[model samples]
Target: MVSKHTLLSNDLFGDLNPKDWPISLADLPPGSALVGGSVRDGLLNKLSQKPDLDFVIPIEAIKFSKNLSKRINATFIKLDKKRDIARLVINGWTLDFARQVGKNLEDDLLRRDFRINAIALKLSKKPEIFDPIGGMDDLKNKKIVAISEKNLIDDPLRILRGFRLMCELDFELEKKTQIFLKNNVDKLSNVAPERIKMEILKIAHSNWNSSVWPTYLELQLLKKWNEDKLPNLELKRKDIFSTKPIAGVFLAKLICLLSDEGLSSLKFSKNEIKRCKNLRFWVRKINNLGLDNFSEDERFQLHVDLEEDLPSLILFLNDKYANVWLKRWEDPSDPLFHPSSPLSGHSLQKALEIRSGPFLGELMRHLSKEKAYRRFFTNHEALEVARKWTLENSPFL
Candidate 1:
């Protein structure tokens, strides 16, 4: 009987020479079989451990498979005593193979989604690029084309994934694919909202935000999804790449645009809607401040008021004013941009000897605003004011 260690070592060193070992085999888990045999001998044994195993390659070893172990930092070990079976971990995913039907790497590339992602760079002897589906040509053309028409139908989420690819790679959707997308926009509703939100956020953060909306409009996806809810969201060509085109604003404008179409549909959660609403309110506030006459205190207050919304606010303000406002805020002499607040609820409680309750919380909030505005300098002053307000309003005090 062949020992498990001998079988594993032979498979591990089978295709790969000792000189080309990318990772030390000693790092692998002890007592673990690198590759296992197929069902004919004992398929149930393999299936029982399927959860721990990664991928299984058939008999035809594709070109991409040659260096798969090196690329993924896996140890290629064989399991079947009767055949040349092997298994390896690639990028933490277990890749296995039965000595039955292994095709070359070109076959694997052909099975992927877009042509752009199908191109793989080899790392072994006579290293050459392998593009099975004109992926390099598509990349050169700056186009996003699917590997096959059936790929999209098999997974409708690919429609949104295509949109995300446009944002990430700054590529254009092929006209035929665009048409198909428009025709099948309703299929997106079948996908989960969380997934849709993820893709939309990716687009909103991309440099192609402005271009993305028009595509959304042209494809009638906005209408189908009932995204028109915000007001006066005119998507000019310039807005696509604007720095202020964040996810919140994009969603707000899309909702507003959809609302205008008499649809009033929203794809975000309640918290997300609230965040967008807050962003819109603050963006308007910052915009109306008019950078020319913006005071240091006002800018500082704006920063404090916006808090987490500051970056997006600045982006929005900059987009509207064309860096005029951002430049103004960047000036060292600008007073509106203040330092961080020195007060906190805990500090207030300790300083005032107050218990954990709404009274102290309210007092702290009032003091924070006063401190932010530079109305009070010392804790004593803040406490005095809080005492006066508490005494005037409450008999308990």
Candidate 2:
């Protein structure tokens, strides 16, 4: 179509060239079409680090994917047999093959969630685009529009996915699409928790000058599966703008949105659950430790206590507190101790002449606190404090 060719030369094609399409597209089976996200990304410069190429093969997908994998030396994976979908992974490049939806390609494209993700490129020596749903216009405008009103009804996951794309591609949801999402927000309960968690992570990890997450919450998308609601925004909402180093910072905001019951209900993995719990606990702990400023060493030790969760801890802090804590950690002039201790646990054990036990952990905690708050500048001074602690605190020992 003339309109399709016109879109090919637009700013969306800045990053990639259609001529640079993968070798797999060079050959094709009958009724095969290079459609959906891969086609959109090719035109729109939205290709991720590893390009994911999606294809529609109305024929036997498993047999074709396996053959294609062998031909290209890629890994063959069957995603959904009933749906007739398979995948070929080669050197970080994922080519997903799915059986055509409905009776034909036009029907398939129309059934997709968003028009922007519904375009296709015919498989031939000279591949021309097939834009049945006006996806090109949507891309040029940087707007996400559902191909049809039944988009959310067909797949509830798109509610979260729409917001994810908004964050990922720096696009806005079209008014009617937003309305559709709001009306069907509760439909997300039908989607899997694992799928929901991944979408949540994508939103949390999105690096954007302005955020759509608050809007996502406003639409009640989170409560579809999660009965618990994000806390009222009436409380001092942290300013997202003017904030730096905000990667995964949304998890801290996420903590504010959840209670213990709400968190437990999402069915996060054991480790993920622990990390989130640690985030919640430390936020409260630091808040309670307010006004009485921790000494440089004390702050460093507090950061050390938080261990792997230091980023989220920094996120929990107010701007002033974050700046102070970051300065203590980063500024060379600041006197915060090295995170890697000069004295090992073995050295501490030797100084205290203690064997392995629960008390060793307690002793380490006390020594770390003393070395921090008590202004012990050397390991020897720390040992002296340890001796005094043993005499006074370990009376039962």
* Highest-scoring model, TM-score: 2
For model 2, how many clashes? Answer: 0
What is the alpha-carbon lDDT for the whole of candidate 1? 0.52
TM-score for candidate 1, please give it: 0.57
For all candidates in order, the CA lDDT equals 0.52, 0.68
Candidate 2 residues 1-397, lDDT tens each? 5575745644333344444544444555866777777677777765665567788877878888888777778888999888889988776677788888888889888888998888887665445577887988998999999876687688888887898888778898898898888988878778877787778777666654344656666686776344543333222333432365534455665665455555566666667667767667666666677726656555655656555555556755567666566555544333333244335678878777777677777777666555545468877877777778777877476
Off by over 4 Å in 1: 1-111, 121-125, 192-198, 220-228, 231-277, 280-305, 314-354, 378-380, 395-397
* Candidate 2 overall lDDT versus native: 0.68
Task: Please list the Cα RMSD from the true structure of every candidate, rounded to 1 decimal place.
Answer: 12.3, 4.1
Q: Which window of 10 residues has the lowest lDDT sum in candidate 1? A: 37-46
